[model samples]
Target: MKDKKIERPIFPKKAIITAGMPYGNKDLHFGHVGGVFVHADTFARFLRDRIGNENVIFVSGTDCYGSPISASYLKLVEEGKYEGSIEEYVREYHEKQKEVLEKYEMSMNLYAASALDRAGEIHKGVSEEIFNKLYDNGYLAKASSPQFYDPDFKVFLNGRQVVGKCPIEGCSSDKGYADECDLGHQYMPDELIDPKSILSGKTPELRKVTNWYFKLEEYNNTLAERVDYLRANSNLRKNLLNTIEESLKPPVIFVKRKQLEGITDLEEKLPKHRTIDEPKKPSITFVFESLEDRDIARGVFDEVGVRFRTGKTLVPFRLSGNVEWGIPVPDKEELKALTFWVWPESLWAPISFTKTYLETIGKNPDQWTEWWHSEDSKVYQFIGEDNVYFYGIAEMAMFMALEGIKAGDKIDWDKINLPHLIANSHLLFMNKKASSSGAVKPPMARELLEYYTPEQLRMHFLSLGLSKGSVSFMPQVFMEEKDKQGPDTVLKDGNLLTNVFNRLVRSCFYTAQKHFNGTIPVGEISDSIMEESKEAILTYERHMYNHEFHSLIYVLDSYIRNMNKYWVNNMRVADTSDDNALRKQVLIDAFHAVRTVTTLIHPIAPKSCEKVREYLNVNENLWNWEYIFEPVYKFIVDQTMHKLKFLEPRVDFFEKHQSQISF
Candidate 1:
C-alpha cells in the first residue's frame, strides 16, 4: 500500500550514448550544443544515476576527415589565413572543440577524433572491418555514378566544391551540392541543376566515377517495415519518422499531366510503371519497380521534352569516393585509390570510440561486441533532425546489412542489435536556420559561456521542446531591446535553481546549524511530503526513460517552487509562535525535499548539485538510485557523529553570471 503509484519505466542494464560528432572544420556553434549535445549529455548523465555510472558509456568526437573539412582547409590556406597542413588544421579545431566541451562539463567517456590520436588508429581499423563485413555479406555493390568535374580548375570536385539547385520537387534548401543538399536530400550528381565549381567560378561537368555503394534501394521494404516497428514501440520524434517514411517510398518521378498528352502509347514508351493519378493535382506520380527502371524512364522523359522532378526515395548510399583527405577504404578488385566517404565512416565512428575506450581500460577491444550487440546493453544515438536521412535511413539499413546479408535475406530484427535514434528538431537562431557563414551569424558555443554560466545555458537548452518542433533561441543580449518586453526566455529555467531551489537548501542548512548543532534531526518525513517526493521521482524516471527532457524541466519547476512555498509558509508560523516542535518537524520535511531536489537535478546541473552534496557532507552514494526513495539520514553511515559543513552568510550554490549582475 505504501508503494502505490504509477509504475516506473525500466532502464537498460548497460547503455552506450553517442552525441552527433561535430565537424573539425569549425568549433561547435550554439545549435550544435543547444540542439544536440546538451540533450545527449543530459540523457547520458541520467542513465549513470538511474543505472550505475559504470554501466553507462557516453562518447562523441570531431569529424576530422570530410569533404567539408577539406574545402574549408583549402580556402583558408589559399587566402594566407592558415600556415599549417590539413591534419594540423583539423587537429587545431579538434582541440578547441574538446576544450569547449570540457568547459560545458560534457561527461564523455572519450572524445576522440577520427584522424588523430590512438582513437584515430582504432577508427581506421573499425572502418575497414565494417566495409569488409558488408562486402563479405554481399551487401556492397560497384556502381558508376556521375561526379562533378571542373575543367578550368582541372580537378575532380568533392561534394562541397559544387553548388547547384536541388532537382527534388518542392525542396526549400538554401544550397545544393554535388550529391546532396544542405537539408540532407540525396540525388545523383547529374541531377543537380546548373552546377558551379567553387574552385573556378565556372560551370562543372558530370563525369562517370566508379565507387563502392551500399544497395540501400534494395532495403526500402525492410526499412519501411522497421519504421512501422519504431512507430508502434518507440518514443520517436514525429519529424524523424516522417522524414524516414518519405525516403522509403518506391522510386518515382513527378510529371505534369499536360506533358503526358503528347506521347503516343505512353504506357509502352515508359519503363514498367504504375501511374498514380491525382485528379485534383497538376502532376501525376509514376512509381517504378526499381531505381534502374526510374533512370531509364528519365531518359525517355528527356527525349519527349517533358520536364520532371524526382521525389525523395532511397538512393544507393555511396561508401567510397575519390577525396584525398578521408579514411582509407579497403581496396576492392580494381578500385584502389578510393577513400571512405565521410558519411559512411562517421556512422561507425562511435563503435571505434567504444573499442578505443575499452582498450584504454585494459579490456579487450573485442569486448565492444557485448556492449553494442548484446540484448542487455542498448545504444542511444542522439542526432539533429538534419541527419534523419543518414542516421535514420542510410545508417540503419547499413547496420542491418552488416549482419551477414545475402542477395535476398529477410533480417530477423529481433536478433540484431540496433541503436535507438534520438533525433531532435532544429534549434533555430532567431527563427532562422543556423549557419556560420550565412546572414545572421550565431554565437559560438564558447561565446555564450562568456555571457552566461554553463549551468544556466544547460538548463535553458533542456527546457526547449525540440522533440516536438523547431524552437527559436532568442537571447535578448543579441537582439534589439525593443523586440522583447519581459524578462528573457533564456533565464526562466535557470531562475528556478538560482532563486527557488537555492533558497530552500540554504534555509535547511542554516536552521539545522542554529537548532540542531549542524546535524539533521532524525525523524520521519510527513505522509504528504513522502507522496509528493514519490510522485516527482517516479515522473522524472519515466521522462528520462523516454528522453523527454523539456517535460522533466517542468516537473522540477513545479516540485521545487512548491517545496519552497511549503517551507516558507510553515517555518514562518513556527518561528513566530516559538514552537520548537513544529520548527524541527518542518526542518525535517524541508531537508527531505532538499535531498530529493538535489539528486533529481544532478544530471542537468551537476556542479551546483555537487555543491549541495558537499555542504550536506555526504559521499558519492547520495546520487545513486539504489536508495532513491529513502530519507537522507539512511545514507549517513554513522548519523550521530555526522555534521554538515558550516555555511557562510549569503552563500549561493547556483550562481548568476557577472554580466547579469549590477554593481
Candidate 2:
C-alpha cells in the first residue's frame, strides 16, 4: 500500500481535569505517582495542548475525614494538646498536607473537604440537608445504646476504649474485639471479665446515649441496584458485588453454658489437643453441650485459632481490646443539660487542612458547594483498593447526611450514590522504597521523573492500568533493561536510570542543535514529505483520543525511534560537507521528525519540552503539524550548528540496573 499523507486538526476548546483526592492519614509516596497523579497530569496536559489553555480546568483535593483522621486526633488529645479550639487543630494539618503535595508537582485547582473550612460548613450543611431529607422520608432515627464511659476521664467511651483479655483461650493478647480476637476467636464484649478503659486505667461505667443513624437498610435495595449496574459495566463494581454477596450469607450462632438448662457438663468433656483431623475429638461436648457454652467454646476455639458467630441476630462479634478514640455518645443528663452536644471532631492535622486549602485560594465558602454538591457534575474517585470503604462508601453516606433542603438547593444524594467511579489501582510494592505506613520514602513518581520523561511514565501507567490492575513504580527494572543493551545505548552501560534520562535529553538536544554551524537555521521543506509526517502525527492524536494511551506511546516511540534510525543510516558525511541541496534535504527531514516528536511529547514533560523548544527557538503555540511542517521548522533546522547528539538505543540501557533492582 502506498503511504498516504493525512491532515491533523487544530485542537479542542474545553476540557475537564481531576485527580484522586489524597488521604490525610499517610504521607505521599511513589506508589501514589505511578498509581494516580502522573496519569492525571498526563491526560490533563494532553487536553491543554489540544484545547486552548483557558478552556481546560483540573480540580482535586485531599480526603480529610473518616475514622483514620479521627483516630489520629484522639492520639493528639492523649499527647495533651487537646485544649485548643477545633479551628486551631484543623489548621495545623492542612498546612502539612499542602507541603507534601506541593513537593510532588501535583498542583491541583481545589483542596479536599475539611470540617472547619467554608467547605466544611458546606459539607455540614449538605450533610444536614441530606439527613433532614432522609428524616422526612422516614429513613433516619435516633437510638439509645448502653456504652462504657470512663468517669475518671470525664468522658463517655466508645467501644474502642474498653480493653480486655482475648476471649480466644491460649491466644493471650489484650487486644480482642467483642466479636473476634486477634487470633480469630469469636466472643462478646459483655462476656469480657474485668474489662478496663485503656485511657484512664479504670473500670468503665455503662451509660446510655441517644445516637443518630441513617436507615442504611432502607437504601440497601437502591445500593444493590447501583451495584448491579456497575458490575455489568465496571471492573470495581464486580469485586464489590462479590463482597456484598458473601456478607449476606447465613451466620454461625454460638451459645454459652450459662444459657443451658441447669446442667453442668464441664466435667463431662476432656481437654483436647490441637489438630484439624480431630476437630471434635476428646469430647469438647461436655464443655460445650450446646453452642450456648461460648465461654468454653470460645476458649477452646481461641486455643485452636478458629472463629464462629451468633446465628440468632445475624450479627458478627469479635473479642478485641482497643483503647482510646471514636465519637462519644451523650448521656441522658447531658441531653437535658445542653442544647446540643459540644463534642469535638477530629483534631488531626489533616482535619485542620480543609480550611487551609480553601483559604489558600481565597474563595468564598459558598463556592465550594458548587463542585461538591452539584448534581450536574459526576464525581470520579481514584484511590488504592485499601481506601475504598472510607473514601468511597463512608464518604458517600456522609455526603448523603449533608445534602441540601431541596434537590437543586443542595447536593443531590441520589445522584452521588454508588455510581461514582472508585478507580482503585492495584499495589506496586518496592523493597527499599515501599512506604506503606512508615518512613517518608520518596514517591515513585518523583524518582521516576528523575529517570523517565513524563511521556514514558504516562505510557507505563496506562499500560498497566488496563482496567484497574496494579502497576509498580520501580525504576530499576526499566534502568536495568536499558543496561543489558550496553554503554552505547540511551542509558550508559553502568547507570540505567541516568542513561535512560540521557536518551530523552539527547532527543531534546538533537532538536535544539541541528546544524554543525553553531546556530540553528531554517531550511526549505518539500510539501510532500511534510504531508507524510503530518499523517503520522494525525495517527498519534487519534490513538490518544481513543484513551488507548499505551498504543499512543507505542506510536510516538516508534516514529521517533525510526526517525533516529533514519538519521544514523543516512548521516554518511553528507557527500563532502557542503553538497548544499542534498544536505538541506537531510536537515529538513530531520527537522520535521524532531519537531513532530517535540509537539507530541510536550504534554508529558512540559518543562523539559519547553527547554527543547527554547533551544530550537520556535513558538510552542504554533506546534500543530500544519505549522510545524512549515518553513519555521526548516528555519530552526538551518540555524542550528552544534554537534548533534544521537539518541542511544533502549536495549543497552537495561543492563545498567541488573544488580541494583530486582523486579
Q: Pick the candidate with the highest lDDT.
A: 1
Question: What is residue 185's positional error in candidate 2, in angstroms?
Answer: 18
Off by over 4 Å in 1: 1-5, 405-408
Q: How does candidate 2 score on lDDT?
A: 0.46
lDDT, candidate 2, 368-464, per-residue tens: 3443445543333444554443334334443443442221233323455232433434545443325444353555344444554444444455555
Tens digits of per-residue lDDT for model 1 on 1-663? 275656677778999999999999998899989999999998999889989998999999999998889989988899999989998998999999999999998999999999998999999999999999998877889988889898888889997789988989889997999889988999999888788998888998788999999998888888888878778877676677888998888889999999888677767888999999989999999999999999999988988889899999888999999899998889888889899999999999999999999999899999998888898899999998888899988888888777654334666656667888999988999888878867868899999998888999999999999998899998888888778879988898999998889889999999999998998888889999989998898888888888889999999999999889999999999999988899999999998999999999999999999999999988787889988998998778688799998999989999998898888
Deviation (Å) of 244 in candidate 1: 1.3
**C-alpha positional error of residue 170 in candidate 1 after TM-score superposition, expressed in Å:** 2.4
**Model 2 segments beyond 4 Å from truth?**
1-26, 32-34, 50-57, 62-90, 112-126, 144-209, 231-378, 390-422, 426-428, 431-468, 471-560, 572-603, 616-663
